[model samples]
Target: MSDHPILFLPGPTEVDAELREIMARPLIGHRSAGFVDDVQQVCQRLKWLYQTSQHAVFESAPATALMEAAFRNLVRPGGRTLHLVCGAFSERWSKIATDCGRKPELLTVPWGMAHDAASLRQKLASSPTFEAVCITHNETSTGVIEPLQELAAVVRDASPSTLILADVVTSLAGAPLNFDAFGLDLAFAGTQKCLALPPGIATYALSHRALERARSIEGRGYLLDFVRAVPETEAGKTLATPCVPLLWALRAQLDRIATEGLARRFARHIAMQHETLAFMHQWQIEPFVADSAARSPTISCLKASGRDVRQLAENATKAGYKIDQGYGDLKGKTFRIGHMGDHTVARLQKMLAALLR
Candidate 1:
């Protein structure tokens, strides 16, 4: 295991040794009583992590699967979905809606800018036919954090019938998200980023509104259908066979997170964000998201200026550290540094020092 390089880019951030050990434990039957008990316990912790009392379910697939599930289960055929697009992930949600046969309208801002709540309100007022609103709480591609609570409030007032679906794949554990209080219909996050686990499991909290919406939508697929999962969940099990190893890892990781306390965990991420940004400013390299208020504390996307960011990442990797040169269209123009999960200030400082050299 020592031969494997540590991950620092984003999603699959470094997992702690203790959690890894849990993943290597003996396999258990998915339908066994022990497994059912384990799932229930993990679901409870997930609710606490999301800061919601809503029903939380674990998906065996990655975060993208849950995103698709949200679109499929919430939006009926020929229904309309309004997607707030500012980065790659948000754009993906628009595509997902289209693929699900729903007509999707995009309210777009530039890559680095946030989709302001007022602008969303304006769009909602003009287009009241939308069945749902999809927002990426944190865009991993651009390191932008949307104002989830404010946007939710606007959507609630503008169209009470339109369900609000948020993707918090990269932001959940590292930041604060109140699913129920914010009036969100559904919110999903993968375990890899802030949960400090592997990449197989994605957890989601579903409000009663989302479930009611699903009840009205016909032809909702079986695997991801929330309507199906909710009934099986009541029996303390998944509708399908879940990844047992990932669940073990998730249980262990959630225990570790609970031990650290959510506020302190969020603070640690903020500290790393500030430390990395401060170091980048010394080199005259500004962050991709110009407004600090819109920046993500878990992931920092740094504009490369005139520097060859790809080459910088290659060099940094050779120095026993792993990093990313942004994503999609921003690949060469920006570089990203992730400080979520078990990453520490000293570790981030060392990577920054190496890059600054």
Candidate 2:
């Protein structure tokens, strides 16, 4: 086994050695013709990975930037948006919408519970003014996985005008997200999570409708405006200079993911999640997300129960395995274990053994 300590924490999770090497490649000019070709290839691969033929842009910032971009570009001033709030990140989406001067109605559930599609349907039915709906496909804070397809269907049936914007920061690469098939207006994820790449870059896919929305709106922020990004993306470049090293790392990681194949990769994640949940059961600990259906396959949020989760995490870290101590409102009450990003079954078993010991 490698002597290096492994990362089981969500986001900035374990970076594969090959990907690390890719990032170490000498930096290239962001605007060079060769670099443009590189960026175009990366974008194409991203679209393939996202299961969408639509445009996929690589952002220099993390997923948060893309979140803000969604609001600024898609939701016009005075436009109404329905934010499905179930955890810290989901709430942040709502906050971003409001910050963009849009009136956003929040469909909230407790941190540990999944947001219900039926409730969202009712909300949309009653509120005809909503122009878009924002949802987190996987909530990292509470380890809850919202039913994206069901929720998308609900929104489509209730409000055809409502564009569906999804955050898949934690779910992408670990699970299957058919962006085109689901008809999502926009979706984005960071490279640090399931992509097993280093931080500093995010990948997002945009539908034709999303582009139209952006074109209709004026004075959207220059950096994140889809109208600006789309043309530059078609030209095989970015609006501004990008983190070239991170882009190389992303390409490497996507290549690895492709080699593994999506079906096998998703199944591997599911198996690891099940293994972690089984261990949690043995310890008499419950998952933060109570409904198994709502639990994320990439990361498992385990309730700390009577134990000090912080201390437990500290102890685990000292043993060379790092884990997450939850986030936001459930910080102390829960802990998260990431099973994504090149983490193998043997590695997970070893970590579980160390924790149980």
Candidate 3:
């Protein structure tokens, strides 16, 4: 209606106008007391969003930087890690571990498939004991959603000490991820997706056990180290310069999130997913993830069916809809529909209508 193409890519999703205005506010000194208060409040809201009573981490970098932080802190050098790979993003976790000098064994499932707790338990039973188990809560590349609570339960039962580090980049705030309830050691997210903010700021949560592990682990480095971040955070200070404007925007966004309530927010994402799926079904297009239980509520990766997906994407773009053209090897074979951030069911319906035309 505004003559602007609606964004339906995974992330960074469209930011609300209010958030954009907030971001445009005048910059402030990161070391000022006011900035410190802003960061502290942002961390508290992040903890509530993560549903964790542990350390709420703040990094002036993107979520990719924190991925390195998670591996460095939780897995120590040469530590064995069990990586559950289902899609492009999840697969990157293993590479990160390898690059970080950790021994990572991957239990790879085909794209569009999910790993349940029982399956993970079986995998762990046969595999060597791992210091950390890494997983992606939502696989944006394939639109597959792994059941983290169930998987964490299996880890807890099989290897109680094994740290669970979840890549929640695409799932956080879009879905309900109770970090403490799921017994996860650490989980982190970028603000661009579900948080509906611009990129460049990442929030992370680490459990008490994870902090202890980080303290004992060496070669963790300076910039992304959790050990240094925790004490500074506890003291209401930052270890380095932070993105103050983004923090301001994040605080404003968090307030809106609180007003909407996480439950309602999750329901909004679910409704959008169903609406898109219903449209996809009526159109007779195949879903990338055949299993409904494994489908991501935030991002829907649909099979291109026989249509030229590249042309379809071009058509959609010309028609004022910014949809996806898939990712990696699946590019041009699948198309994704992102339903997260500050988006609503009504907005998606309007966009779908434009694409259908």
Q: Tens digits of per-residue lDDT for model 3 on 1-357?
A: 555666778998888888888888888788888888887888888889999887786788899998888878778799999999998998988998899999999888988899877778888899878999999999989999899999999999999889999999999999989999999998989989999888989888899988998899988888777888876875668888878788899989999999999999999999999999999888888899989999999999999988788877887787777888999999999999888998888878878876665
Candidate 2, clashing residue pairs? none
lDDT of 1 by residue, 1-357 (tens): 235666788778988888888888889898999989988888888888887777887878899998888878898898889999999999998998888888999999999989887898889888766889999999999999999999999999989988999999999999888888899999998888988788888899999878988998888888888889865765677988889999988888888889999889999999999999999999999999989999999999999988999788977787677899889998899999888999999888877787767
RMSD of each: 1.4, 1.3, 1.2
Q: Across residues 1-357, which tens digit of lDDT does each residue of candidate 2 receive?
A: 457778999878998787778878888898898889888889889889889988887778888998888878988888888889998899988888878788888889988888777788788877776888898999888888999988999988888888999999999999889999888999999988998877788889999888998888867888788898877976777998889888877777778889999999999999999999998899898887778899999999998888789888987777798898878777888889999989998889988887866
Model 3 TM-score is 0.97
lDDT of 1: 0.88
Each model's backbone clash number: 0, 0, 0
Stretches of model 3 off by over 4 angstroms after superposition:
none
Q: What TM-score would every model get versus the actual structure?
A: 0.97, 0.97, 0.97
TM accuracy, model 2: 0.97
Please report how far candidate 1 places residue 309 from its true position, in Å: 1.0
Model 3 whole-model lDDT (C-alpha atoms): 0.88
